[model samples]
Target: MSGGIHADTAPKPVGSYPHARRVGDLLLLSGIGPRIPGSDAIPGNRYDADGRLLHYDIVAQCHSVFANVRAVLEASGARWQDLVDVTVYLTDMAADFAAYNAVWQEYFPDPATAPCRTTLGITALPTPIAIELKCIAATGAGARR
Candidate 1:
């Protein structure tokens, strides 16, 4: 029991993979970035014509990434509350974690209701944005998985 989920409102994936894959009752999302849908615009970074990163804003990037994640989850018939696990990648954890955590709280709210998360500091991401998110969500009985 498997399938792929895609949302036209979300940014197209950089690679040839679906936005998320459903296996059994779970939807596993690909790494989602802050890029706007239907365009190469990233919400928090200034980039040159050659795609060089000029400056970054973790707060704006976090919001856009979460919005993208929400779009994918909804497309898969899941909600933010259905998320059970999350993995976050940040290019500079030391410099960005505080701001990222702040925006994260706005989404998850209560600590008890928040999904389990593991955030990693990485050298870079597929794009110039500072943040990305990968999530696993539980699709209830009505979902096709």
Candidate 2:
């Protein structure tokens, strides 16, 4: 727990990192990508016969990305509502902005409770991943695990 005190009571981390760490009342999480359930390959990076990116569907990717984020939160004993702020990094903002918004609305439910966010359009990402999300959250009440 070099970064902070871990709060996860579940199994050991799936990777080389801690599941979740507590800093005061806040819990900062690592970025999450849309990787397959039991596989490390991220979705949406495959190419079609035309050499086009498969699943060019940003909406679907957005959902999967957040769903992965939700999994991390759940595994760490936190919930979506606890998220205070988030940052999204994208490969092409102009093209996928709308789709991203649509999926974000579905997950947020209420705009009032939505966390502050920053979205960036970059030329590339580590794994052809269209999007990646990192978030911060608060642990209320009996916060210890």
Candidate 3:
């Protein structure tokens, strides 16, 4: 059986999808952005009414993104330490990787316990956000085939 998890504290998905899904012992999270819940405001993004990019702050964006991820994890009965893998997408790698890495380290702390990660540079996202996260977590329940 499978179940979906929606976090009231996290931004509502832009598409028709839940924040996460549980299949057996794993919780698969949808791509999470840094947009504030309800307001739909994106941190670190500065755009005009015409929807043009103005400026971006990678650190601030990372903080909000991580927090949003945590909210979904908690809602799904998972924890940061339960995360097994993560996929990160960045709109501008050359300019943002260093700052993003620094902020990421603040959460993972120890390399040994950190989840495996793969980061890629992308051209754009659904919103004006600079970064997003897709995660998989262990649910601590027995696996079912």
Q: Arrange candidates by lDDT, highest first: which order?
A: 3, 1, 2
Looking at model 2, the pairs that clash are: none
Encode model 1's per-residue lDDT on 1-145: one tens digit a residue. 5767789989999999999998888889999999999997888687789877789888998999999999998888788888889999999999999999999999988888789999999999877889989899988686333
Best model per TM-score: 3
The candidate that wins on lDDT is 3
Q: How close is candidate 2 to the true structure, as a TM-score?
A: 0.78
Where is model 3 more than 4 Å wrong at Cα?
A: 141-145
Displacement of residue 63 (Cα, Å) in model 3 is 0.2
Can you tell me which runs of candidate 1 are displaced by over 4 Å? 48-51, 141-145
Task: Report the Cα lDDT for candidate 1.
Answer: 0.88
Q: Model 2 misses residue 145 by how many Å?
A: 18
Name the lDDT value of residue 117 in candidate 2. Answer: 85
C-alpha TM-score for every candidate: 0.92, 0.78, 0.93
Record all residue pairs in model 3 with backbone atoms less than 3 Å apart, i.e. clashing.
none
